[model samples]
Target: MAVLETPGAAGEPEIEVQIRGLMLDPVTNMPIVVLKEVGSDVVLPIWVGVFEANAIALELEKTETPRPMTHDLLRNLAKGLNATVRKVVVSDLRADTFFASIWMEQGGETVVIDARPSDAIALALRWDCPIYVSSKVMRHTRQNNAETAANVGADDLKRWLENLNEDDTGQYKM
Candidate 1:
């Protein structure tokens, strides 16, 4: 559990993060969560899965599925227990793995459960909750961002942009 104070230690305003949009890795075809701060241009890329991204996109696009998804099942259980999701915290990053926790209140008892940042994010969108990343995870994301971006080809970028405009919503195969 990392505490991210609003007034950052260096006197810089803490970067406020929010879901930017959905994109697929041009190389691996894996789904990615686009995190960005409102009014700021810097974006953090976190790779997720096709199913998970679809779940998130449904919520973002405000489309309801005929049947409940896995994350939706979890949310339904939480609601049934009289629980409320507070936030999802991305607590650590090591060797390219990012860890997260879902903070929930059930019957007045607050519980934090370990989760993958990707899964945690999918649920966060459904619950309309905030997402936090420890400074370490943020730094790790930055390093991977550079490596992934540098290797992507010109044709991949052109195709990705077109897909975004068309709202095709399929994962881009690398």
Candidate 2:
């Protein structure tokens, strides 16, 4: 299990989560990666770019391309260097953006690389490593959503996200 210690909330444990589904945002028609906390109903939806969404969806569906995708190349590179991906962490949420870190171990040293959450997640799937989200990120997401809801009357959006089901996600089209 991977855990991130929050600054103010010392000892705060990172929540392990898995990719619940990938779907299009109802309002914006953008891609969303839904991550559900392990053994819990808590979920987080992260909006991602179209290309990044395609990358994640391709991995999720196990679709094969003739040539290696960027993420596949990354996996090959890491393995070629004798580095093992320990885990990926959704580390923070700031200014409506999410941040992630890829933890890799080579020999006796561990390296943490800053990455976009979408890229980190795609790599996580390729590496078959654990995925975690900082508790602080979860808190911030809720607070931000609440504030946005109050300001823009987007409560329905929040409700939709919270109530997403398998049928609601459907299949992601490239």
Candidate 3:
């Protein structure tokens, strides 16, 4: 079973990870965003809702929306306030749910906001901020990865994405 640490979880230092990709879980038919440690096989899969998944996928695919989406609005608001999104940290995993904090810098002061991992991830992508996973979270996820063999080859993932229909992305609202 996978271990998940709650917020304020005391353990190892956080390890930086990059967004590997966004794909649908074959079994559950739910969208999952994959994160991978640099130069390592460690991977974390966070299942997300349909709407948030679409937001992340749009950013990943670099598809420009006709107007600002929620994430884009957040990015624009930050810019207007002269704040920068320093980074987003996937801080914990509790009860199979991941939590995150979005760190922002304004006027030399840093502010951290509690956010769902999916929203944090979407905003992070728009702001071009770095993404990190707490080491405890990673260690727990990695252990689970070993047992379930959750790693998917790049080719397989690419093929899965390629086969998606336009409507599969979900409809967008203004």
Global lDDT of each candidate: 0.68, 0.84, 0.76
| Candidate 2 per-residue lDDT over residues 27-140, each given as its tens digit | 799999999888866678999999999999999888999999999999999999999998888888878799998989999898989999999999999999988988888788
TM-score of each: 0.73, 0.87, 0.78
Residue 57's lDDT within candidate 3 is 81
Worst 10 residues of 1 by lDDT: 165-174
Candidate 1 lDDT by residue in tens digits, 1-174: 223465332332234467766777667877777666445554666788777777777777777889988989999988898899988876776676767778888888879899987788878988998877666555665675556656875445323432353243343221
Question: What lDDT would candidate 2 get against the real structure?
Answer: 0.84
- Report the alpha-carbon TM-score of model 3 versus the true structure: 0.78
Model 2, residue 134: distance off in Å is: 0.6
Best by lDDT: 2
Q: Give the clash count for each candidate.
A: 1, 0, 0
Worst lDDT window (10 residues) for model 3?
1-10
Better by lDDT, candidate 3 or 1: 3
Which pairs of residues clash in candidate 1, taking residues 3 or more apart in a chain or in different chains? 27-174
Q: Model 2: runs farther than 4 Å from truth?
A: 1-12, 148-155, 172-174
Please give the TM-score that candidate 1 achieves against the real structure: 0.73
